[model samples]
Target: MDNRFNFSVPDICDDHADKVQVSNLRLQSFGGNDTFSGPIETINCPDDNSLVKEILNTPGKNRVLVIDAKGVSHASMVGDQIAAKAESNNWNGIVVNGYVRDTEVLKTIPLGIYAIGSIPKKTDKHGLGSIGNDVFVGGILIQSGNWLYIDSNGWVIAKNELKF
Candidate 1:
């Protein structure tokens, strides 16, 4: 799918603040692409990236994967390998409520990655997590199928896809 909405977060907020919910957290960008938007696919996992790997292996159709890592900072939730898969799978972006590793490689991929920070340690592949569920990140309730707009400014969630 082509990128229809290329506007920034502040611009969207200025026009449709009443129709959008902005995430409170100031997530850091680590991907080659800094701006991306798409339908949300939520995952709730804690210190385990088994589900993350599972989803990235499937087709993305330009959708964004929102991983709720329960705010774990001890270990990385995503790294270069997984992110490369996401890019190859046609995923537009990935938003992690936790840390990610391989920052150098992540900066080279075409995917847009937003996370709290970076860590060298990897996550445990316990295959523990739930998919297609509502996840809370930065105090914003991000539900599956919701439209997510992310840029260098921040992220905004809308009930429906918005065109600028």
Candidate 2:
């Protein structure tokens, strides 16, 4: 899957400011692929990553998972194992509102990963979460099926697909 986008967030915003919502959170990129854009798939889970694991297990071509971890600062919502699975499953990227773990291994994955920070603690596996829902992250309302553009500059979302 060719997940690369030629345009940067600033350029996209400049061209489509009225159509895009820029993320306010300062996200750190951890995956190997720095630029990725695709339709959004959202997960709302506060401190549990069970649904995240399940979602990564499925095929993820041309899609990016937007996880709303409810800004949990302690527990890590994603780690190396889940990220590896996402890469293997052909996921373009993952945007986590909270924290991630295994920062070293995360950088090796081919998928794009943007997170608020890193944590050593893993999340609970109680399988408590909802998928395919509207999730608010970084002061923006990211809904399932919305288009997401991400790069070193920042993250942006559009209601419909846009071409550069």
Candidate 3:
């Protein structure tokens, strides 16, 4: 899809032309907030076992899944396995403000996952988390029912559906 009309947080914040800066070989793209305007479904989990199943069942045909991992450093919140599930389910993408595992594998999938870093350890399955709620990360308000736009440049959120 042509991203020229798409709004990128990084470029907008920099007062530069709307241009998406593609990353290098799955490298960090400087992590920017994507503007989103739609229904918000928050998934707060440390492991993919529970979240993965829920993600697979999610009806995100054209919506985004914002996951709040509580910025946990113990383990990864999302990974390639869950990403694959999301892709197969036709989800727009996943935004994890926490850590993710299996970068190499995740890159292979078309899931748009934004996270802090990668971890080698997986999360423990305890079936603990909240779905369909508001979540805040990096002091950014990610309320339910908001539109989130993401790209190679960065991410941004809009209170309502925006036109570029």
Candidate 4:
């Protein structure tokens, strides 16, 4: 599980121009690994990360968690513990549509974490959130099982897996 995904977003786009959806959001990278690719898994955790923790605890071999925090920054939905679990369970990466805490530890984990920003506050853990739901980020609709390619240049969404 050592950054198993290896591919370039720009190269993939050039080859699959008609099959990709590029995101406009400029999310910051906090994890050690900068690039990753995997099948998508959606979550809706607006102001709460209970379900986020739940999902990361499960097996995540070659999958990415796409969290829809309703584009909010007041409450952090993903932090070190949750992200650590993700890396431990072999998750390729995480794309949070909200903020994340533990900026320091997050940068050390060997997982890909792209977030809007970082905060110091954690979620209330009210167990509020939905799983396997479709999420919208950067005006692009991302559904479960969709392929995602993320790198330093940017992230790209494809309806299906593309050959690198």
Candidate 5:
């Protein structure tokens, strides 16, 4: 595999399209961990937890989960259970534009999980939402097929994978 876009790990998306393409006001990379890359899988929902199960059950070998958490400041979209599931399922990483819980446990998992912040609150198990669809986050348009690169520096997206 050529891994065309396999350039230097630290790169920036200079292309601007109206929206800024990042929204979680306080969530930041756990540290300088450059642990996520690859195609995007989006989830745009509120109070829905079924998709979390679906994605966890599926194979995420090298895929990144791009979650549109609707900026739920009061609740956490994921926690220890979800993170453990993702790790067991081989998910490369999870990027949530919302809150998450069990921060201490998450730091121990091998999987990469990025979120807006950690809250003790949890979400409703409505099992309601759509997967593998288009979503607008970070002030940018992000579809299922788009490529996303996430690291401690922040996240950058593009219609197609960018090559160096």
Candidate 6:
């Protein structure tokens, strides 16, 4: 009945490669936690962070929020305040498919934050984008409720929590 994932990404690849889907994007670590794992929550928000903000307001329940920002380089879907809110709400991790702002502050947060890069441009809050949707990025198809595991090596997703 234990759901804790203490296994490393490399070990998972070596032992359970066929059972997990790995992300091709080389996401930079921006949070205090280098290793984290939990069920996935998806957001397809590009150029706007309304959905991101909205979701972060709710209880995370130890879930990881996967955001598909369309790899937008100009606008950041996450920032210091948003990330802090997520941490305060108990989100296990956040994997951004786009850029983020406040790099230094993001690193202090106690969670896993993997993003393509950083930018100073903040996104608009148009309340646009869909939640609980499939996010395709870096040759991986991420859906809500999928389990995501991140370690110092990299990230890997599975349909359910892996027990090792």
Top-TM-score candidate index: 1
Taking the tens digit of each residue's C-alpha lDDT, what string does model 1 give over 1-164? 45534677899999998999988999999998999999999999998999999999999998999999988999998999999999999999999999999999999998999999999999888899999988888989889999999998998999999867
Ranking by lDDT: 1, 2, 4, 6, 5, 3
lDDT of each: 0.92, 0.91, 0.60, 0.90, 0.70, 0.89
TM-score of 1: 0.97
Q: What's each prediction's clash count?
A: 0, 0, 21, 0, 3, 0
Error of 6 at 88 (Å): 0.9
RMSD of every candidate to native, in Å, equals: 1.3, 1.4, 5.9, 1.8, 3.7, 1.6
Task: Mark the regions of model 6 whose C-alpha exceeds 4 Å error after superposition.
Answer: 1-5
On residues 101-154, what C-alpha lDDT tens digit does candidate 5 reach at each position?
888778888777888787897888887888877877767778887767666666
The reply for model 4, stretches above 4 Å from the true place, is 1-4
The digit string of per-residue lDDT tens for model 4 on 1-164 reads 33346778899889999999999988989998899988999998898899999999999977999999988888898889999999999999999999999999999999999999988988887898889978888889999999999998999999988875
Show model 1 residue runs off by greater than 4 Å.
1-5
lDDT of 2 by residue, 39-134 (tens): 899999998999999998999977999999988999999999999999999899999999999999999888899998999999888999999989
Residues 1-164, candidate 3: write the lDDT tens digits: 43423455565546533432222222232122233223445666655447645665756665677777766767877667677777677666667766777877777675566776778788787777777667775566676666665665556565655444
The TM-score obtained by model 5 is: 0.82
- Candidate 5 Cα deviation (angstroms), residue 136: 0.7
Model 6 lDDT on a 0 to 1 scale: 0.89
Clashing pairs in 2: none
CA shift of 26, model 3, Å? 15
lDDT of 3: 0.60
How would you encode candidate 6's per-residue C-alpha lDDT over 24-48 as one tens digit per residue? 8888888878788999999999999
Candidate 5: the clashing residue pairs are: 21-138, 22-138, 27-116
List TM-score per model, in order. 0.97, 0.96, 0.74, 0.95, 0.82, 0.95
The candidate that wins on lDDT is 1
Candidate 6 clashing pairs?
none
